[model samples]
Target chain A: MENVATGEAQRAAELPMDNDAFAGFYERSARPLRAYLARVSGDAALADDLMQESYVRFLCAARSWDGEVAGRRYLFRIATNLLKDHWRRARSPSIEEIPEELFATSPDAARIESQFLLGPALAAMRPRDRQLLWLAYAEGYSHREIADVTGLASASIRLLLFRARRKIARLLREPEAEGRQGRAR
Target chain B: MIPKSCPRQSEVAAQVLRGQWPAGCVEDLRQHVNGCRACGELVLVMLAFQSARAQAVSGPAPVSAGVLWWRAQLRRRNAAVERIARPILGAQIFALVVTIAIAAILLVAQARNVPRWFSWLTQPGQSPGLHFEDLWSSALAMPVWGLMLLVFGLAAVAVLGGFVLFSDRPRQ
Candidate 1:
């Protein structure tokens, strides 16, 4: 146990020495990153696991970035790759099997209806579409930032976001159309 | 989808979604969208989708960063220890296999020679050249079971040494 502690101390020393800086960074970024992971992968547990792994990997990485913006972009890129790798290694859940929290019930009728429409609407899209749309729309990431984070071409983001928006809008309206059809019947 | 006539429709919609239009370009973007039905619909849908997505992913994180950092450190330490112990484990298994093989061969050889040696000993008139004292000083000093037990004891000691060397528990 003493030897292990010594070795761990040695490794910790070798890591980035600014714990306060890293703690600040984690505080600023962890929540949004967790939310991004949960929304993209549709699993809260997986999101938490991936978020920790992403931070660990970020700390271990050797490259340098200019500022917090660049650092954040790089961290997100690492996280995106990790998510892709995970899906490759395991059998991903179908859209219907996405976590229930995404479509949680609410007392307010409008909020409940929006949640109902939004959860499955987002799920029905491709993972890449969901990632691109969420980052662009929900997170307010600019085209270049999304490109940096997602490894997509900056020129392609506009068209892709457009299509993703269209698809989600169409999906959101599908339930209402179904209800109208039921009323007619 | 953008109309064939509006090549900049996607770009305008993307800029609007990101709130990245230049200060002077805002009115141009607005006028362009107001004049183009496709661009107008695209803007409205983008805004609505952004709102829904925000609501979908909003919540508190499951675990805090400090806890995650601690867990990551533990995992890394465990991995390092495993890396150091893997070769020791391989060597232990190799030594055990070799020891068992040698013991098996010795047992088979002794079993085959024991009856012949006993017959030779029973014939008192025949001089076998080998003296009792010499035989007693050599392999015959102990019974087969005793020799086997000694070999097993040595093997056990080697295995125990290996276990101490390659134990999963961290050394103090």
Candidate 2:
């Protein structure tokens, strides 16, 4: 067999050609990917499964990487495609319908209550909206970058975000909207 | 000094908490929230919301054993292909080289065995079996033919062994 080092190095040097430099990339990117998947799917277990599958696909495609910016873009591009495929193959569950038991029980009731409140509010939002929120808030992608990743109009990103936030805020503030709980008096 | 160019404290706090604002905007945002109690409280609530959301959405731990098993299976399959490919390539090259050498040796042997020493001195009525036909047929019956077959058979067996050893077993 040809040397794994030779194959990997050849692939790594192509564009974002530093395959050797992926340990840091993995650590930084994994959580963001997981978080993105979880929010979009509204199912932590499904998100975990997809995250692992996405990484396996990434490893398979590592030999074909072009360079740094392009490589990172490709990684996200693959992830987005996988997510789209998942949505296409499987019927998306209503985030509003995600079970209460999915949230962790914190010793602090306030923490648990806030989580319970936020989980389905996030779920009721569109998948693309969920992705936009997580990428902007958690992954720190700018509007233009999020635009590039999602293939949405760049100028529309700011507008879409404004709409998403306002909707989320309203959803969070109103328990009747979620149907699972009552607002405090 | 807080810039007049910035948005209202509450709006900017909302933007920052939503991660819509640029990272460079955080310093200006902090300055505004420091003096404004309402903005400070809103930012605290937003931060708390973020923390809770993060905690709630975190996925389960990875299955290390399953990942390891997958990697092991991939490596084994690759190793088996490599073992088989190397020797098959080597044997093909070796056979070509050996075939060329043997053909050259036989040509030289025929050239030297052509009665080069005695041909000039012999009468025209010499033994009929001394012709090229007799010499060519005798060379074909030599032990080298058997040796060549043995080499080829061994190479085939080695490749077959590699295939048998490396082929994946169907998991139950």
Candidate 3:
């Protein structure tokens, strides 16, 4: 592991460190990456930290990537692994326990409503399901891109995404159905 | 328009999200979404989820690129320092242990000689005829090479100690 880290560091040293190029990359990807981390982990602070780490690690990665899209996908992969490491090292809070600023801060009424409807529903689902759904819907990543970021089989994404969508729809509807039933009573 | 299950549901949804649906198919896709309850619900939820994620991430990043670059540089420098220091640290520790062991052996030998030397000194009228030449020829006399070794060992230990102490000091 140490050797691998060292070798990666050497490779990073050899990679371009042009400030202009890096700044451009950061400007393009930082916000989306932060949002992805925040949505997946449901922690803004952790997202912020992981955002920086992902960029740093991306710049320091041993392998070279071809284009911006590939680089961005690789960055997401690094962020996912970092999140997994965080989970392995420490017990993470459930989605419901995530701070409100992560999902509830938007001033737009429609956005707020969507977040209100989706946040808890997302929190209620497994992390992997949330990841798959978010990558599919939110990030607009295709099955292959999702597979790349998630380390999942590309063949399985469609089925998994379909299942996840159904689950989220059920979760979103359950409260309304209960409320209607209560009103009738 | 509302089939029970379209095989192209996932593909259509993905294309809609990407804003890449063909112009000719947009009307048909819209009709299908409006007519099909399951597809409509999926599209609605997916769009809502996408909007919510966009809003959630719309905030500015906490730190800028320059700061991140500075941190990366700092990390790289620290790693480089550690790489250089590791072997030196190992060597210093090894030298320390050997010096301590040699010093300990010398102390024990000197301790055994102390009582005999003291007894010899306290003996009355026993060394009146003993001269400086006799003392120089005595078995207790330290050889030139031995004296040089002791001096060199002490100096080496002191220099190494100082080097270790100075190098281990915390940097600002």
Residue pairs with clashing backbones, model 3: none
Per residue, candidate 3 scores C-alpha lDDT tens digits across A76-172 of 8999889878865665464335543344323343344443677666655667777888887888888899999988899888788777777777777
Instruction: List residue ranges in candidate 1 displaced over 4 A.
Output: A1-18, A38-128, A139-160, A169-185, B1-26, B45-62, B108-172
lDDT (tens digit, per residue) of candidate 2 on B63-136: 45346235533554554455445765675566656656655655564566568446645754564346778657
> Ten-residue segment with the worst summed lDDT in candidate 3 chain A?
A100-109
Candidate 2 chain A weakest lDDT stretch, 10 residues: A9-18
Identify the leading candidate in terms of lDDT: 3
Give residue B170's lDDT in candidate 2 (0 to 100). Answer: 36
DockQ numbers for every candidate? 0.20, 0.07, 0.25
The better-scoring model by TM-score among 1 and 3 is: 3
Model 2 spans with C-alpha error above 4 angstroms: A1-23, A63-74, A91-115, A178-185, B1-49, B52-172
Q: Write the per-residue lDDT of candidate 2 for residues A55-161, one digit (tens) a residue.
A: 65665552555655655655666677777777656564643354443432223433433446666666556777777776665555677888888778998787676
- Which candidate, 1 or 2, has the higher lDDT? 1
lDDT of 3: 0.70
- Considering summed lDDT, which 10 consecutive residues are worst modelled in model 1 chain B? B53-62
TM-score of each: 0.59, 0.49, 0.68
